[model samples]
Target: MATFQRHRAFPWLLLLPQLAIVAIFFFWPAFQALRRSFYVQDAFGLGERFVGLSNYVAVLTSALWQQALVNTLLFSASVALGAMSIALLLATLADRVLRGAKGYRTLLIWPYAVAPAAAGVLWLFLFDPSLGIISRALGSLGIHWNQRLNGGQAMLLVIIASVWQQMSYNFIFFLAGLQSIPASLLESAAIDGAGPWRRFWTITFPLLSPTTFFLLVMNTIYAFFETFGTIDTTTGGGPNNATTTLVYKIYQDGIVGLDLGGSSAQSVILMVLVGLLTLIQFRYVERRVQYY
Candidate 1:
């Protein structure tokens, strides 16, 4: 009994520092934001009056808010899908085919080591309409691609930029998951005359379900929140608010507009949406994750 208690207490003690940091930095700020959302900012932004749920109603009723919400959801879903798919394909190819696989893996993950803002800047240069390298290449083919003039192109650029940055993370996770699967199982499948695709779908994919589920949750949150840098650098939510996602809108309200109350309300909504998504994924897909 003493040993079990000591073991558990030791782990808790080790976690105390991190837990304290989270409480102070994360939970406290979130609670403050929630409290602030019920208030209104004064003319000079010095005072706040308790407006109850009016701010929430205002945000919900606003058409611009609605568009931001939809754009956020679409961006999150598309980027997560694109990142996961491309990473899975790359990891599979590296695991199966490529010579000097470790070298290739190192090279592949190198882009992720670059700072997010730097990566965004690099991609912006490549996609720049006037004097970009890729722009020149497309011009040779008489294909004009201008993200600034087109909303769809702007969204695509954002998605591609996000996917490019995140694929490394997904690739590492998936490669680890693939490598963890026992060779005996794959050998048995091969003996049963299963093709590579069939073996992967029937045997490997099921084993990888847990990793996939984890990545889906993490990547969704990341796509929604952490891609703000990329969006800020690449699009500035431009072309008539076409690329303005919820996080960017929050930034515009809180930081740029100095409307802390409205921004807090937006934050509350974002937190609720993310919480619901996480819950749904764990509740529904968790049972489907089979382990060897």
Candidate 2:
């Protein structure tokens, strides 16, 4: 009995380091943010006073906060849908090619390896109004392109940059999902008079539901937090706050505006939003995920 108990506890012993890291790095900071959300503090941290829920109230009532919420939703939805759709298409095409499949996959996955900030800067250079190659090309076509001054254009540029950075990740997962699908099932569907499109709809798509659902959750979270670098480098949430997301707003409030209490409250709210969204996805969306 002692030996058996020792073996069981050994696994947990192995997990201790990881658990300690999480507690120290993630839980500790989250706890600090939560505590700070309830207190007002000076910019220099020379003084602090408990203010209860006032910070939350201020954040909820602010028009800028509401605008950031709307912008975040739009950005998240656009990035998730655009990235997943393009990745799926590319994965599907890549899977069909019999020659140079590894080479094609290598090229497809290279974008995901690029740092998000670097990717954003690259796109910004291509779209910069003053000297961008694309901007000049657009001028030649009589379409004025200035993302800095145009709210819609700024939003579009950030979304495109975010999507481009994330596409390769989705592609790798989708390609793996596609390859995992049994060939016999598709062969049987084709034998039963289903056309290529029909077989894909009936067999391929249904089998891929699991991958799609997983990517949906992951992409939503990525858009919420990981796209901060992209937005910062591309637009800085500028041009009348057209592309200001909640995370960016938190940075602006805490670092730039020096409103620590309000920023903490916003961070807490964002944490709650992420939790709720994740719960809703797992509760409703997971039911249809069709895991094999």
Candidate 3:
């Protein structure tokens, strides 16, 4: 029994470092944000005064914050849906590769290794108004693509950058999920007169639900928080604040605008909002997931 207890304690001992890291990096900052939310601080951090819920009220009532909320929802939805859909398609195609499969998958996964800022800059050049390869191609086709002044175009540009940046991550999970599906099941469906599309809908899709659900949650989180670097690099949430997401707004308020209290409130709200979103997904979305 003592040996058993020692063995059980050893696993937790291994986890101590990770726990310390999370506590220091995540929980500590979160606690600071929560505490700071109730107080307005001097721009230079020389002083702070407790202000109750006024910061929250201001953030909730401001038009800019409202617009940021709307933009955040739209951006998150677009990035998550677009990335997952494109990744699923790519994974499906990659799974069918009979030759050069390693190279094909490797190419698909290469983008995931690129930092978000770097990826955004790469796409920025690709879509730059003048002399960009894609921009010139669009101009030749009379599409007149320019993100500088057009708010809608700017939003689209950021969305595309975010989707492209996250798609590689989604692809890896989807490919793994696809490969894990039992080949015999597909063969059985094929033998049963089920067409490819029919078998896919009946077997492949349902089996991939676990992976899809997981990706949905992770991608939503990515869109909410991780897209900041990409959006910053690409659009700067610009063209009249058309692409200003909640995370970006928080940065603008706290770091740029020097409204520390309002920014802390926004950060707290964002954390709670994401937590609720994850719960909602697990509560409602998980019902559709077929683990087997």
Clash count for each candidate, listed in order shown: 0, 0, 0
How much does each candidate deviate from the true structure in C-alpha RMSD? 2.1, 1.4, 1.7
Model 2 has how many clashing residue pairs?
A: 0
Candidate 3, 11-101: lDDT as tens digits:
8889999999999999999999999999989898899899999999999999999999999999999999999999999999999999999
Candidate 2, pairs of clashing residues? none
lDDT of 1: 0.91
> Higher-lDDT candidate among 1 and 2?
2
Candidate topping lDDT: 2
> In model 1, how large is the Cα lDDT of residue 228?
92
lDDT to native, each model: 0.91, 0.95, 0.93
Tell me the TM-score of each prediction against the true structure.
Answer: 0.94, 0.97, 0.95
- Among all windows of ten consecutive residues in candidate 3, which has the lowest summed lDDT? 1-10
lDDT of 1 at 290: 85
* Candidate ranking (lDDT, best to worst): 2, 3, 1
- Least accurate 10 contiguous residues by lDDT in model 2: 1-10
Give the per-residue lDDT of model 2 (tens digit) for 1-292: 7777769878788999999999999999999999999999999999999999999999999999999999999999999999999999999999999998999999999999999999999999999999899989999999999999999999999999999989999999999999999999988888889998988887898899999999999999999999988999999999899999999999999999998899999999999999999999999989987777
Sort by TM-score, top down from the best: 2, 3, 1
